[model samples]
Target: MTPHDNLGYQRLFDDGLSFGVGFPLTNQNDTMPDVDEELRLARHAESVGFDALWARDVPTYWPSFGDAGQTFDVWPWLTQVATVTDELALGTASVVLPLRHPLHVAKAAATVDQLSGGRLVMGIASGDRDPEFPAFGVELSDRGTLFRESVELLRTVWREDYPEVESSWGTLDGEITLVPKPTTETVPLLPTGYARQTLEWIAEHGDGWLFYQLPQSTLESYLADWRDAAGDTPFSMAVQVELADDPGDGPEHIHQGFCAGTEWFRDYFSGLNEMGVDHVLVGLQSDDPEADLSRFADEVISPRS
Candidate 1:
């Protein structure tokens, strides 16, 4: 499948610079979330012209790590969200490839893609959490190799119909098949955070890049390097922001993101657009999530769109 095959991919990159919101939609930064409230805000986001909604994969909560992403299983969470929202694209940002079997990932992803009407853009990664490695019987040293093999296997199974294949994870012959193919020819795979591979390798294999927040100078350099290697493949990043009530508040660093006013956010996203970032996943930090989402729509997303 080509880059434009999946609906989520097309919605994200084909449009110049689009906006999305991360899950939980709260500042508590804990595993527990008000599911009904999140669903309401998700639909609100789409109604206001956001391009996508991103969900993360975290099988276990490691408190020391300081974040439990939306705290729901990625597949079921995405499927449920898909049922509620008609046009909003759903993404995994991302699924840990080395921790799970490739066949499971392939089947789950295909199912979500089909159910969502081809809206799944899979963000895949080689996990970085150390404890998760041993817990899943995956060696830290072999994660890189496992990651590479998993990516290859996912693509192979998606594209071929009951084809013979063999890998470190397992093997498949013509006798067996993985059913319920993606509504599209294939789901778009965006490799997140290098996944223990070289830039060259990532550029060659990934349909897009999903990255974390970077300082302006650093991001410019990184984007330059990516453009040199990957050509027109899309680049995406996540930024944490707490939109202040005052429209003129300047940016102050907050963890991997910023606490700023809507005015500053407009300028910030405009700069990202100029820098060739195709998508930005906004993680809202607020007590009143619905109000924050509305303010973002009126002030940041509306003007930009």
Candidate 2:
């Protein structure tokens, strides 16, 4: 599989319009919940023409964090979710790369891809919460270095037959073959704000960017920087949304332009397209999950996307 084999990033940007949402892994209370229902919800999203679903890693549920993304462990959930669906792309909102050995990450990710028949996209972050870092014996300050090294090792093992990797994290010597060889050329590995790495580093090395919720103006600025740094490579972001029953009701900003109502949601996404946002992984754990999700699909996502 060559670079061309990866259809997810490209398809996302096609027709100049695309929409996808983040899977609500936890419940409204921000605790680990049964994922069976969430898995079905993901399948529902895919059936409704949604392009992708995201899985987030929550090592320790920090209620203070306010939002707890999909509760299941990232890689294991990816593999499990892959079995329940066939067409929709499966991805990680982000995996904390610095917390685990890159070899383990690579192996786990590759296994998911192989089992899923090459439909896995892994989003990696340097990590944010201070608690998670010490838990893994990784210093919070060194996350950037660890992130860069981890990515280098993952790519080397995946793309090269007998790979030799050198980095601050560790090294791989002699001929090594990372199995399952990503049915596609390479699995899409996106970078998050794991560290304060240069935009040039991300543009040149990462397949995409996993960013936080940002307003339209902010997103434009980010896209410009990314384009300058990355040239033609694609980028993605996660957004919070509150769907309303009223289609014409205006939006009310919750965090970063996340709002309710179909009209406002439509306009927001329209702005995203104009801003050159390739994909948006929305978190729909608002006051009303089913209503918001249904309204979004029927009114907003269905019409424009």
Candidate 3:
């Protein structure tokens, strides 16, 4: 398989518009809950036809950011989640690349990809929080450069054997080998929110893009630009949703998504599909995500599917 023969990519885009949910799938709030409950919800999502399970990389708890992506270290947590589910694609919604050693990211990602039967899609970002950069000994201003180098190094080591790589992160002289290559020729790398790079750079390097939620018009404009740059590579979005108890409830705006009925979401997703969105990472906002997830599948997913 070439770099493009990605199970996660195929799972996301093959069937047109697919839906995913962020973990800890148990709660949308900041507190991390029981792993056993998370696993149970993971199986529930798979059974209900959700296509993927997304994990967020929040290196530190910045109180200002609030949620902390539910505060789990993404790699081990994602691996645990991957173990129970048979077929759901596993992904990092966006890992902050500038804060990490590229070699570690490469090995960890490849291990997960191999373990999950090539279901890993790496969504990476440049460091965002100002505090996080200095905390990691990374300069905030240098993140764009660091992000580029890290992406280059990640692709290099994944695809090349004993690669002679030299970068700000470290150097590999073909003497030291990185073990456990990905299940594919290379695991899919999707840049999250540009990572401070140009669209052209992302298009050339990424398998796809994982973007933030946008209004339909804004999404149209961005999609137009993406099509011109990277034809047919998938473009995905992360959104928060509050699925209403009643199927017929009308639309109400939330932070980045909606608080509305299934009817509104169904049409909304249809519009998104028409405009070329590949996947939607749904962040269910209720305390009880399990119920909302199942309702979404029945009321929004199965009807269209």
Candidate 4:
């Protein structure tokens, strides 16, 4: 078996396209979520065959942004979910790399990776929230540099026991060591968006890519570019969906996704498969998420699986 077979999320990409569910499993857009219900839906997703459960890292809730993104700190929430579910991958749709200290991020991520038994896949970003930069005291202009350095730091700390390393962030003097290393050789890192880096840089460094929804034409174009730069590194995207009650309803554009019936989703996902998409993180909007999840599993995921 290869390294891909050893990592939970990587396994999902081995064969063909696999599906995952993003957090805030319900349609309730409130800043706070009913934690119990979210957990219930998460486990149900696993039981029904979703490959992974993704959480967003929103350290502060900017009212203007309009979504709190599962409304819980990603580390604790994911660790708790890991205890209850088996074999389902736990991911951070993105942890803002430039905003937080790379050491803290490294330690926390490794802790989760160890606790989850190698199930963690971190999706990192340079951050796009304008207000967050100043609040964190991170310069927006230097984010691209900070982002690159942070990635290097994370890899160095995780892969080496203790090595002398210096960066604008800080210095590791080979005296201190990060404990509880990842269960695997290294934790998989997928960069979200461009993270202010060129496509070639991201392709050369990232384990995978986490992208927002895009139109088919645009996505095809992006994938073509990515393949040339990254060669078979998995590419994943998120889509929001409101499953119409009718199985025949066609797709209608919605916020970053579409409102569609089961048949339409099936065909849509199939097209994605043909396009060489490795995985998709589905964000569902429904009054009854549990029922909707089951229906989606039976209709869309099952056929594709």
Candidate 5:
């Protein structure tokens, strides 16, 4: 089977690679973007040849924690991004599974996946912001249980013949299958942060892994662990990048990304591909968005060295 059919995501897993940019809705500096501006940014990234545009579900803006992700409701933004872009893929950097029911996520994701003509990629996570969980009347401690149940339920609903599911959240009694099953052979589900699963469990179940930033040396070891866990699957991660014009500007470490020059950025990604990372989604607001996108496309993506 092709990578699209078996891996459950569009495009090849190996053979080449995929580069994408995350929407800069918020940052460590506490800068809030205008919604229209964010949309324009996404469009520009697509036009410049980034394969996918990712949005994070930030129900509450936590400036202290850093990064607001793309603005607007996550589901609606997925639909909006899908409508505006003709080729670029649409994705959720992740949706907090514990906050919304599995059924809602299943239906909405499938609808957007179908509507987007297989461009939608779903990233599921246990909730991150500590305070946000209690505010939603969900106990933060139960997120592990909630996440597993939700994942299982979503898969069941998507099956050709929906199977009965029993879980603490609820149960399926009748033949209530999720409609408009994903046009793609299988839906993509990425697990975020470490969650509660072991490496083996993640390897066996997740389509891809979404992890936080790591140092270059440490990143090698971390990805080694993931490759051991992944076997043959794809893995993705988010990086906080600040690409500069001068080739002399070197990398200075940040919380989850690095500040570096364009050449350094290109070299770093080339190394990442050699290390078995199928995709790398860079957050590019700190750089000159237009120039950075153009330079990266021409210097890095086009060559694919």
Candidate 6:
């Protein structure tokens, strides 16, 4: 069977246009989240009908970068999340391919998928953090090449048992097998943000495409290009939103998204679906997590989903 028939794909993309919460679900990220509270929000998101929960993989926090990576590591954190929620897709917003070994990634991913009962979607990327490249001893320039090779290696090891392969990292002499293959035929790999490859290459290889926030007209152009090469493969994008209390508040432009009211968001989602977007990763930027989460579910997600 094809990758789209996988349970995560069916749950996340087939039922209708689905909405998911990008993690650290609280916009009030002033301090590290309490474990209990974070898990509660995760479970809350599931109850409220979020299709998936995405985790970010930031290896070493660069203070100058203004990003601490993530409070917890991607695999263990997702494993914990898998324990708390039943149906939500547990995803890595992306794992940097150039930094880590593919065998390890495959093993960890399969483990999570097995534990999660086959609900995992991986977003793969050629990383962009400058300091990260040197620290990991990876050449920043060859990221695009490494990104392609990594993808090829992952598919081979995951699908072919004891497969003989020679790769940049090392040669697999077809001696040992990687255990706990993904519950699906293979994990769905969505390439995020071009990953230093041509759109044609991404369209040909990726299970789907994961993009970032874009202006409306630009999005239309991008999706048009996607359809030309990728055809019906799914597309997902992330957006930042500051939910205003008023139903008619301004659609004020923000960095990657908008500060808007519920009604405006509802219409915006509709426009997105019409433009061939299969899923949206909502980054809620408001102060009240519980309240905004529920409201978004009731308004934007309910009608479309």
Each model's RMSD to truth, in Å?
1.2, 2.1, 1.1, 1.3, 2.6, 1.3
Structural similarity to truth (TM-score) of each candidate: 0.97, 0.92, 0.97, 0.97, 0.90, 0.97
lDDT of each: 0.88, 0.74, 0.87, 0.88, 0.75, 0.86
lDDT-wise, the better of 3 and 5 is 3
What tens-digit string does per-residue lDDT give for candidate 2 at 140-170?
A: 8888888888888888887778777778766
* Steric collisions counted per model: 0, 3, 0, 0, 0, 0
Q: Output the worst ten-in-a-row residue range by lDDT, candidate 4.
A: 1-10
Model 1 scores a C-alpha lDDT of 0.88
**Residue lDDT tens for model 1, 1-305:** 66486888888888788888999876545757888888888898888778899999999989889888899999999999999888768999899999999999999999999899899998999997789999999899998999999988888888888889888997787888778777776788888998999999999989889999999999999999999999999999989989877899999999889999999999999999988999998888888888888899899988987
Sliding window of 10 residues with minimal summed lDDT for model 6:
26-35
- Return the number of clashes found in candidate 5: 0
Q: Model 6 residue 29 lDDT? A: 40
Model 3 ranges with Cα > 4 A deviation? none
Q: Write one digit per residue (lDDT tens) for candidate 4, span 1-305.
A: 32364467665677888988989886555568878888888899999999999998988878788877787889999999998888978899899999889889988988998888888988898887789899989889999999999999988888788779999998889998888777766678899999999999999888889898998899999999999999999999999989999999999999999999999999999999999899899999888899999999999989877
Better of 2 and 4 by TM-score: 4
Which pairs of residues clash in candidate 6, taking residues 3 or more apart in a chain or in different chains? none
| Model 2 CA lDDT for position 208 | 75
What tens digits encode model 6's per-residue C-alpha lDDT throughout 1-305? 56665677777788557888877876434346677878899999999989999888888776676654446788999999999999878888889999999989989998998899888899999997899898989999989998999999888877889999898989999898889898877889999999999999999889999999998999999999999999988999999888888988869988779999999999998999999999888888767788889999998788775
lDDT for 89 in candidate 3 is: 89
